[model samples]
Target: MRFKSIVLVSHVTDLSGPSEAVENYLKTRSDRLGVIYHPFHYCADRRSRMQDYRGGTLLREARQGGWNLPALATYVKDALFTLFYFLRLGGRYDVYLGADPLNTVVGVVLKWLGLTNFVIFYTIDWMPERFSNKLLNAVYHWLDRFCVRHCDAAWNISPRIQDVRRSQGLPDAKNVLVPVGVDLEKIDLPDKSASEPRDLVLLGALAPSKGVDLVIDAFPRLKERFPQLRLHVIGKTPHDAVEDGVVYQPYEPRLAALGEGVILHGAKPHDEVLAMLPAYDVALALYKPSPNNLSQWADPSRVKDYLACGLPTIITPVPEIHKDIAALNAGIVVDYAVEPLADAIGRMLADPGQWRSMREAALAYMRSYSWSSILDRVFEESFRAKA
Candidate 1:
């Protein structure tokens, strides 16, 4: 059976990993899919830069603290555009899928305004509690409740987030857990490649929540045992500080000074990052527990990425990873503490035979999480049946 049409609305465009994954999934299965994405503000091309009409007003408001007039104006304009887009394609679509709270809100409002039919709200992470103050949190909580109650179905990246929605009293709640899946075909590993001298490689955004500091602290101890061991950190620094007086900056110089083997390669495109995965001995995922960490409560996307690359992982014992590690025997888990983390990395690196075995085990485990399998389930359970 074919969908009449599927409408996707998200803040991120096709350029982002999450958006690209979802878009690719829908495009592969259906010809009647259309997308309405928020303007891309970070594109370098001049023509593409003009596509984001929201930035001008936001920049002006950054100079002065109160209500951001320009940002509000941009949001209003986008909402209007969404309304027009919804009406244009409303009759042809069987379902509307939105990623994130803002997009969900827009979809719900458009539906309420008689612009569309079935609405599916996809939750990548928990919102309000993660990013809002007390008053805004209350408002967002009510908004989430409203969306969950009104939408035909809810799609969450993890079961943990589904629990959060269920607790909020959503009725007939169809919580579909759709964790990001691995594209096995894209992640090709070299069979007889020489391993880098590095003991651990941490990949993903270089934010505090990702626990870059923990890895840095752990590196010194790991280096003591294997003097030639190196730690390579790959990802972009945050543009602004999440905490007070703690500005985000590149960790290269600071980390390099602490040891001889710490190298920060900054952020590269997703394909480039995946290409380097095979060269490393182990993939380290040391995210600290935080409000912003919806993935910490659920399954992290990077764990699948690491496994797809056939690399043994050393991750903190987050609930999701803990369960997977035990079931799959894919990698090692340790406490988030520095001493244990260092010990875990050292243990994996010290034994080549064990490391090789774990690598094969990780690949075997990752086979079940290919995008085709996961997306097929998501389509059947979340969208097709529900609609």
Candidate 2:
């Protein structure tokens, strides 16, 4: 019944939704666990430099650095760091788990080095086909497939991803769909009187594919109806003002030009973000649908968090979220187009009774998706399975 240790490797230590899920599982469960994070070095540096605006500056810096390091240098750097880290700590763990493709590559190498008893690749996104460069994308695919082939088991966050792996010829028994879970006990419906203005809230990384710009574009039309409406954007910003030697633009000014309704809150602490959730009338998951491999296959963590808070969700009709909304009848799923989103928000605001009904259903659905419940099964079944 006891594991010697469970090691989790991921890209960053920041309070990302996926990292929070892993932390929740480790802290609440009885298992012995340790985490090793590979934070983006330049982003971390910019955060230390910029006193007031860390997130935005860091993101800009990351973009400027480009997605990949110069080939020979990256391989050498990753190899050395991976070797040193595993040599120091890997032997103590009975099971090693990696949270993304990058970490999975490292985990597979560590296993080859005989550093751990077993290795599990836990993927939250499919990255190979999502990268911009065809050549690099091919390389990423090869590494991803190599990792999957060598790993003992794979943990996927959505069935869409499991299907992708299977389609790529991976064995069915090697992968399990473990959608991200939320802390239902920590979230509850606050009194409506406590709600702020009928503002829309969007939370997550402000990257290109997140579709924040689309929401900004749609706001003017929305304002024609609800002039008092507000939009609160909460998450980390870019790392620098210059990306790839070009001046990086801030989203604030552009979004503000649409109207005075936009507010940029930057990144808040986990509890603070959750506390602020109930203050808003509706939660938005406005990411654009892309055939880009990652976007098409991944399940967004914010969707679960928004639903767990019992807030009515306005999200795009992405396959995974669409399926959840259809099954639970918990939230509204609209097309990625701004018109549909604007109209949906307007209708929900106009009909208080239906909005309340959706809110209750969302809360009910969240109860069954508690992190405690999900991790108990994950521990007993996946992590504990013999190699």
Candidate 3:
């Protein structure tokens, strides 16, 4: 009783795992999948977008209300638009997978209205304090718990999220840990010798929480120890000091001030990031430690990308994926500090053999986390349970 058709009511934020999963399904079985995506813009220059896809083809793509829509207004609009869209389709989907609590609530309502057979609440990120506004934060949790209790199942990106859900007293709800996966098929790394100077790469938003600042701070000491080392950052920084409710100082100027050896290639396409990751020897995911940091509950896509590209990663303990990397001997897990980060990179630089071994382990570990395999397993088990 495999589910033949699926739909996702998701917010298109970045090229994260959920996006990759959608791509995987669309590529193979487009006729069996549909998506309603809303672009989460960080700047007013870009307008709000809504895209609809079915059978690997774009059904409709629209931009309206510019970027001035309030958060609550946006959610209401999304829900109403999705309800009408699903109604127009006559609700033939076997499964409805939503990317967040708001999106999942839409799916739950669809099920109540007899539009979809099963609803999957995909929990990508969860923080103790999700919203800065007290009222919004409370509402967010209420919606989150409501979705968890009402949806058929909850798909969490990390085990820690499942633990958090339990602590929130939703332990009885069906929970599945669907960790971030890598696209191994598109990876074509240059077959370079291990003796080549091992350069470092960090692939994510250039925000302080991503440990971009820590990497930059550690760069000088690391350079002093290993003169040939380079740090390649491949992502965009916020235009202002604040955007998307997260206040972060833009690192573009600081990165530019680093002169040479520190390359700041702002926001490359996802395919390009995959192509570029293999050129580096070590990956940095030094996420800052904070109780409110959502990365702590997420299986970061960047870490999976690094592993897939066969680059040994150096990450902090904030993400649960770090424990897996540390246990598998695929990467070093250091504290989120300048000195520890520098020391770890220095250690990796001094031992090329160990570095090579870790790289091999990384590649080996990523085989089990390929998109094709992960998606296949997820749908199979999910559909079986529904049957």
lDDT for each residue of candidate 1 in 75-124, tens digit (9 for 90 to 100): 45655555555555433355678776667888787677666677888887
Q: Rate the local accuracy (lDDT) of all candidates.
A: 0.66, 0.67, 0.76
All candidates: CA RMSD in angstroms? 6.1, 6.3, 2.7
Better structure of 1 and 2 per lDDT? 2
Runs in model 1 lying further than 4 Å from the true structure: 1-4, 13-15, 38-81, 84-93, 171-173, 192-199, 244-249, 258-260, 384-387
Clashes per prediction?
Answer: 0, 15, 1
Rank candidates, TM-score, best first.
3, 2, 1
Worst ten in a row by lDDT for model 2 = 46-55
Name the best candidate (by lDDT).
Answer: 3
Candidate No. with top TM-score: 3
- lDDT tens per residue, model 2, 1-387: 345466676655245667656655564342445555554543433111101112112112111222345543554455455445554442456677777766777777766777677888888777445556677677777877887788788888888778877887777667677878886666656776333337788887665566677787777888888888888888755664432234556676776677587888887777777777766778888766666625557777778888777678987776477667756767788887778888888887777777777777887877778777776776566654543
- What global local distance difference test value does model 3 have? 0.76
Q: Give the TM-score of candidate 2.
A: 0.83
